[model samples]
Target: MTRPLLSLTNVTVAAGRAATAKPVLDGVSLSLAPREIVGVVGASGSGKTVLSKAVVNWLEPPLTMRSGEVLFEGRDIYALRGADMRILRQRISYVGANPMGALDPTLPVGAQIVEKMRAVVPGTSRRTAERRIIELLDAVRIPSARNRFHDYPAQFSGGMMQRALIVDALVTNPVLLVADNVTQPLDVTVAAQVIRLMKELTTTFDTAVLFVSSSLPVAREACSRILVMDEGRIVEEQSTDDLVERPVYPYTRELIRQTPKIWGETVSTSRHDDQREVVLSLRDASQSYKVRKKTGFGGVNLVRAVRNVAFDIRRGDSFAIVGESGCGKSTLMRLLCRLELPSSGQILCAGRDIATLKGRSLLEFRGKLQMVLQDPFGSLPPRTAVGKMLEGPLRTHGWRVEARIRERVLKVMGEVGLPTELYEQLPLGLSAGQRQRINVARALVLEPEILIMDETLSALDQAEQFKLLDLFEKLQKEYDLTYIFISHDLAMVRKACNRVAVMYLGEVFELADNERLFFDPGHPYTKALLSAMPTLEPRRYRPEECLLEGEPPSPLDIPAGCSFRSRCPQAVDKCSRLQPSLTVRERQDFAACHLVLPPTASGGIGGVGTTVP
Candidate 1:
C-alpha cells in the first residue's frame, strides 16, 4: 500500500488559554492518500474550519494545536523551521471561503499571484511567472485569461475571483490543497463548474484535497471519502455513498435530513390562483449605468443592468428570481423595491406607478414594500439594541406613543421566533439564524404588504435554512404576506416558491410555475441551472449534456442576438441574428427561445425536450 500523503494522528486543537481553553477539534485523526479527495462536513460551529486550518498550520492567536502530530510525507510539519518551513508551505496551499478579500485590491489580481509564485520558487523571472499564471487561468476556464491579467480584484465577478484563487492555490503544484467552504458564496452553476475543475485538477496535478464545507451535498460532489463532525469530534467516517445513504450517528442523519432536496419527494402544494390581485407589476422596465473603462483614459461604457423585464407578482405568492452571479438579480431587486427608478418603463404597485409617487405617497410606498437585505449582521446597526432597531421603522411612520411602540416591537419579535429576552441585547455574537430573524422582524414591524428577500438564506447553514424556511411559511400564512425571493439556491426555491423566473444577462429566459419549470423546463438556460443544482437524488437532467461552459458575457458587451446565445448549447444560426421575445409556450408558461414552438403551432409545447425521470 502507498504511504499517506498527509496524516493527522490524534490531533487536538483548542482556542484560548491553557487553563480555560476549549477544544475545537478533539482527538481527530485522518489520513489522505496522494490524489485522493476527502471531505469534512458539519454545522457552523462544529470545528470543520478549525480542522482545515490546523492541517495547513494556518491557525493563529487563540487557536492552538494543543496535542498530537500533523505529518506530511511522514514528517512532522509542526517542528519544521526556517527554510524547511518555507518548503513545507510551498508543498501545501490553502484556499478560503471569501474570494473578494483574498487578493490585494490595490494590485492587479494576476500580478499578485505571480508575485507569490516568484517568492515560493526563487530565481523565477517575472516574464516566466506571468506566462505560467495565465496558462493556469485559462486551464481554470477564466474567460480572456490574457486580458483579465491586468484587471484588478474588483473587476472580477465572484465566480471569476474564486477561480483566480484556485489558480493561486495550484500555481505551485502543491501536494495537498485545503479548501474551506470555497463554493458557499457562488451560484449553483458556477459552484458546479468549480467542483468539476477541482476534480480534474486533482487528477492532473496528482494532489490530495481536504474539502471542508458546511454543505454535505457540495462535499459529496467533490470528495470520495467523508467525515462527519459535531461539537468538535469526528462522529462518523465512511465512503460518501454509505455515509449519505446509511448514516450511523444521529447527528449525521440529521445533517442529511436537513439538506434540501431538489427532485425528491416534496411537500409543497400548488398556491397559484389567477383570481388573486396583482400586488406588483413591472411593465417593460429597464435600467442602465455608465461605467468607466479599464484604461485610465476618460471613456465610459453603457451597462444595461436590466432590460425590458416584465413580470406580475400576485398577492400572497412566493415568487422567485434565480440566476448566476452578474446576471442582474440584484438590479431587479432594487427596481422592485423602488430604491432605484427604472430608466424606462413603469413599476406599478397596486395599479399605481411607483415612479410618480412623491412625499407622503413615497413614504407610504416604502412602508408598504419593505426589504430584507442579504447580509444579516451587516444590515443591522451593531451598537443599537434589537428593540430600538425594530422601533426605528415604526417611529419613522408617525408612531408617537412609546408604550404602543414597545408593545408592537415585542409582538413582532415573537412572531419571527426571536425571544423577547433578546430585545435589550445587542446583535453581537448572535448565531447567523438569530441575526437573520432580527432582520425578518425588522421588516415585519412595518406591516408591509410585500417583502423582498435578497439571498436572505444564502449565508446560513442547511439546518438554519431549514428552520427559517419553516418560519417563513408559518409567517406567510398568518400574515398573508407576498414574498419575493432573489436567490441562486434552486433547492430552497423548489421548496418555497410557487412561481419562478429564470434570469440571464439582464433578461428573463423563462417564466413558469415551479412544477413546470423543474419537471419540463422550456429554455436551455433554465435547464442548465437545474442540471447544475447540487442534490443527492438521481438527477433528471444530466450535467454533462446541459452544463454551460465559461461564464456569461459582460452586461456592457452583451451579445447582439440572444443575450444567452453565447453560452447556449443548442444555439442555431437564427439565434445569432434575431433575439427571441418572451412568448407563451404552454398555458401561461413563457419562454424566450426561438426553438420553443407554442402548443398551437406544434402538436405540443416543444423546445428542448423534457427530461426523462
Candidate 2:
C-alpha cells in the first residue's frame, strides 16, 4: 500500500568466474517498510551478503547484478548514476561481515564516529559533534565515554569496537541498517545486547534494519520478518514466527532442523563433571592484562581479565565457562592452556604447580594442553596446505618418518570429517568451517590431555558446529581428554559441559553444574546472561526479557565489590564495596555473591565441585 522503503525483485548473484558461478540467487524478491527489521539467513555462501550489497549498490563487477531491480523509496537505485548513486549510498548504512575489519584501525573511535556525522551534516563543528559523540557512545552502553573517546580502534576490545562501529553507522542517520555477519565469534548474551540496542535505536530513529546472520534461531528471535535464502535466491519469505514454526521450503526446514538451540540446555556427560579423575584446579587464580599504553598509569590500566576464577576440569569432562563478549572468557582459556601466566593465585595441573613451568617443562606443558582459537584466519598459516599444517606440530614434537607424518596428518583429517582431497589444498582455498576443522585437527594431532576451545563453535553454522562439538565430545572420551569449554552460548554450554563457571572482570562469579547455570542461576550476572539468551519458541518477549543496559566496567578500573555491579539488576550498595570471594557453603556450589543459597533448592544443579585449574 505505502511505497516500500526498499525492495528487490528477481535478483541473482554469481559465486565465481571460472567455477560455473552458478546463480547463487534465483529470482528472489522482497520488500521492506519504514522502521521495520528484516532478517536474511541461510547456509554459508547462500548469497545473503550479496543481496544486501546489491540493495545498497555496493556489489562489485563480474559477480554483477545480472538481472534484477532494486528500488529505494520508489526509485530504482540500480538505474541511478553519478549524483544519484552518491546520494543513495549516503542514505544507506552497511555494517559489513567482519566488524573487526570495518572501522579505520588507524583512527580513534570518537574520530571515526564524528567523521560520519560531519560528512553528512556539512559545516557541523567538532564541538557540536563531541557532545553528540558522548551521547552516542553512552547510547551504545560504552563506559567512560569522555575519557576513552580518544582511544584507537586497537585499544578497544572486540565487542567494544563493534559498539563503536554501530555508533559510527548511527551518525549517518540512515533509514536502513544492513548488518552482515557482525555477531561472528561473540557469544549469544552479548549478541542479544547488541540486537536489543539496534532494535531500540531503530525504533527511536524510525530506522529499518536488514539483519543478516548464519544463525537461523537468532534471526527467528530478533526479526519480525525473515528472508530464507538458498544459493542466491529468496527461497521463502514469511513472518519470522510463521516461518520458524511452519517452514514450507525444504531448505528452510533443513536450517531449522539442523540449527543447534542456544537456550534451555540438556544434560551432558562432559569433562568437567568427572569427580574421580580431576586433572586441573584453579585455586583462586586471577589474570590481569594491561591495556595498551596511554590509557593511564600501569596499575590504573590493568584489566582483570579473569579474577579469582576457580573450576575443576576432570579427565574426560567438559567444563564450560559462560558469559557475554568482553567478559574475559579468552583470558580464562589462556590460563588453562598456560599461554598466559596468572597475575595472582595459582593453578595445579595433575597435582603439580603449573605456574612454575619453564624451559622444556613449558614446552612439555604446551604439548600436553592444546587450544583451538576462535578465528581460523588468525590461527592458520595462509600459505600452508592443510596436511602440512597438521604435520608440522607432530614433527616439532619429535615424531619421525616423513611418510608416517603424512599418514598421521591424513588420519586426523578424516577423524575431523575432512576429505582427503582437501589435504593438498592451501588454507586460502578452504571455507571458514573447513579452516576451523583444520584448526581442530591440528590441535588433535598433539594428543593432548586437555583441549581448551575458546568459543570455537560460535563462528560456524548449526550443522557445522554440531558436527565439531560431537566430534570433540567423542574424542574426549576416546582419548581420556579434559576440556575447558569457554563460550556464552548457554545451549551449547549446557549440552557440551558437565559443569559450568561464570566469569566477569577476571574472576569466576559462580561455578555449578550446567543445568543450574542455565535453569537455576545464583549470581546476578549469571541470571542476566541466562535471561539474555535468544529463544526460538517464536513467541513475543516481555520488556523484562530484554537484556540489561550499560556496558561492562572497564577491566582497567574494576569496582571493589563486584565487577558486574554496574550492570547487575540486583546490585546493592554492599555489592559496591566488598569484593566477594569464591566461597563454598553447604554442599551446593561455589559462588562469589553475597546471596545465601537455599538449603534445599531444587532448580539449580549440584555436585559442581570447585573451581580448578
RMSD (Cα, Å) for all candidates, in order, is: 2.2, 3.8
lDDT of 1 by residue, 424-481 (tens): 9999989888999999999999899999999999888899999999999999999899
Instruction: Report the poorest 10 consecutive residues by lDDT, candidate 1.
Output: 604-613
For all predicted structures, in order, the TM-scores are 0.96, 0.91
Please report the TM-score between candidate 2 and the true structure: 0.91
lDDT of 2 by residue, 1-613 (tens): 7788998888766655545667766787998898888999987778887877877888776676667788889899878987777677567888875667777889887987787788766777999888888888888888788876898877777677777777777775789888887776556565777788778966787788989988887786568999888777777989988997899999888887666554423455432323477688888888776555653666335666776666666776687887776777777777777777888888998787798988888888778888898886788988887788898888888889998888888888888889999888888857778889888889989888888888787777776777777888778767887788877677677667777888776667887766555555567677777666666743222327435676676676676777777766566777788887765633436678766444344233553332221
Model 1 gets an lDDT of 0.90
Instruction: Please count the clashing residue pairs in each candidate, in the order shown.
Output: 0, 23
- Stretches off by above 4 angstroms in model 1 are 295-298, 603-613
